[model samples]
Target: MDDFREHLMKAISLRKRIRDTRTSTGIGWDIIEQDYVLTWVLFGISRLEKLQETLIFKGGTALKKCYFGNYRFSQDLDFSVRGDYPCGDDLLELMIKACDIATQSAEDVAFTCKRYPEKSPHPEEQEAFDIRARLPWHKDFNTSVKVEVTTHEIILLEPEKRVILHEYGEHLNASIFVYKVEEIIAEKIRAILQFAKKLHERGWGRSRVRDYYDLWRILQEYGQQIDTASLPLLVKKKCESKNVMLHSVEDLFQDRLMEYLNEWDHWLTPIVPDVPERDVVIKELKQQLYKIFESDNEGVRVNRTNVGAA
Candidate 1:
């Protein structure tokens, strides 16, 4: 109980600190709120890591907070397990426990969490939780944080440990599981492929601009570190697991990467300031994707682009 109180006090203190630091120009209050929520989420994940060794953090938030520094503010926490989570344990209950532990560390905000059961039979598409957090001091700001669990086999090749610092302050450190940089890059590529597949079947959905941006950012910062030889197989395995078939990995890249280009600036400009000029980013990404796909098919060629239309 004392620990919980300490967390609550620290949370409130951090909340005030974040509120006070919201003077940065050109960034909206909503974005600042998003940052605040992200801070709380990181603190929450830190607590979970202490209590649950099974859940290893992955995805955009992990990349942003743990490895990649170039990503825009991400709204959710994603995790994958080494194997099936024990049967009959409610995910929401588990998150609540994690949240409680988090509140103990910083109890400034109120957390409301709801579990959405897995809608698909595929093990990879596991259940998710929607967490809505409201700071008691800031009535106008209620942030939504999604927590998605990936049941697919997470190959944590060259896993790295990162101590996540609450941006409002640094004394609070939360350690998290982060996959190798190359694996994360492969995952981003896989995300674009998956997004394309979903779009083809449904005709409309969320955008994959973030994946493109993250891919570009990683390639720019850690391009040499990415395991070039292993990427295609990794991406292929991911597509197979999701039952998402692709006629050609190169074609998949050409179609999706091109499509995402049209909306890139619209979605990316606000969050990522140094967003490379369109032609530069697209050209660079195409070259990288082609290299990843070349080992499998030599016929891979860059699709002609009408930069003006895009």
Candidate 2:
């Protein structure tokens, strides 16, 4: 058993090295950039907690764990607060105060706060006022750090409503709790469909289509038990807004899903190879994620285990 365990560990390590190589060779640096961004967001969150404003992890990072394996890289940090809890101006003041406590200047951070503006059919229908902040830092003689902070309102839901939306109603989990696997898959499906339409409209590269296809495959393989009743509604809404064709969601489960799964298995699966300096990158990320969650001096805590082993 001990020998088997050692071999397993060795194999895992090798696989990780190969995966890392693949990521580095591709646009994986975007993921690393996102990690840096999240680090700054966590710093701001820590500051916010000092001022008595609680922030919860939401959106893609949460989905990275809840849907894609935690190993995937996410590009942004999103948080939501109760609509009636406080005004946007007050939240900015609190955030600014938190920065002051940390001896960080407001100009050094990307900070934006605003209410969700009304939506209409004008050309600017998508435009809304949002509070945004930028925190800048000098990393080295040539490198600098800038972190963006933005605040927006989501419909306030009762705890039960939030739970239902997070657990079953929505594809991505709501901010009210730890993200779940099912919600992530559902959200990704929605995102894929949306992106596909955008691609069709712009006549752009097939990246979005390919990613949507890949995500669909991953979800189908690992997300068979997901509740899918709301999927059609989600597809219809996103497609209607984007002016894209509404592909049958059932086709996602039946076919094309396996093709992406096979691609991931063949391309992403790690191979046993000696690679130095690999552990350093993984260790740094783990530490950063830990620091962000731990710095919330307030009682608010993220259910870290829910993200799973990755």
Candidate 3:
């Protein structure tokens, strides 16, 4: 009984701290609050039976949840699943189980899992759904924690087990399989190129400039440790799986790098306290990203660090 009371008190305290965080961090309360629930959802998925064996956590959320705590407020939980994916109904059942686990673990938080139809040209290549998390702190606000599972990726590197960072207690200490820094970097590169091609061909695209934010930032964090030689091959597999192609490393980004860099600050202003300067991010990425293809590139530092590991 006393424990429940303590949990309730802590939950209330968290609400106040969130407001303080918003003021200090200059991020929206909505994003900070939703990121809290996203952590729980990730923990819930980690606890799902044998699901972790098949699902490889990747994308921006993986960077935030598994690698770095100070990353952007990424709401989507993206995964690459091996073999046959569960059907819509079955996947929702699994998501419900995950939500139940989150509800059980977190105080004053409840999640309802649901799948909605997404209109995509190649819908069979990917599956995405969301679990709406109801927040006790905010009476009028609730947010969807998006879950995306894709069959379009081929896992080239062995998945690494990384510790999950939670805002609360030691009981939340759990780990899950995630993409190596190398693969995530490669895929983000492919994603950027893919978006760039669309913009050039159709004169309209999503302009997923966040991939650059992720690319440069992650490269700054994990650049030296990556296996530079294997990255190009990894990137090739990613692009091919998505039917996108990049013929040269020097020309990988083209004018698109600078084009998207222009939108970086505006797009990231809401999600992070201080967006990085455009010139700094691109300058660094251009130098290191090329090394991903030039296996023979000299002076390429190869210190494999364990900062991303448990």
Clashes of each: 7, 20, 0
The runs of at least 3 residues in candidate 1 whose Cα sits more than 4 Å from the true structure, single-residue gaps closed, are 1-25, 49-51, 84-89, 116-125, 153-158, 245-249, 253-257, 297-310
Query: What lDDT does the true structure give each of the candidates?
Result: 0.63, 0.37, 0.74
lDDT of 2 by residue, 1-310 (tens): 9977775665455345435644654535333433433443344444444322344444445444334433444444454443333334665566445434333422233444344354553352222223333323223222122222223322222211222111111133222233234334344555555544444467432233223333434443544554444334443443454444334332222233323233432333232122213223223433332333333223223344422221
Tens digit of per-residue lDDT, candidate 3, span 69-163: 77888777889886565645777788889889998987778888877567654456576776787777556327876888877668888899888
Superior by lDDT: candidate 1 or candidate 3: 3
Candidate topping TM-score: 3
**TM-score to native of every candidate shown:** 0.77, 0.40, 0.86
Candidate 2's C-alpha runs over 4 A off are 1-40, 46-59, 65-69, 78-82, 85-187, 205-214, 217-221, 237-310
Candidate 3 overall Cα lDDT vs. reference? 0.74
Evaluated against the true structure, the overall lDDT of model 2 is 0.37
For all the candidates, what are their Cα RMSDs to the real structure?
A: 4.8, 16.9, 5.9
Best model per lDDT? 3
Estimate the TM-score for candidate 2: 0.40
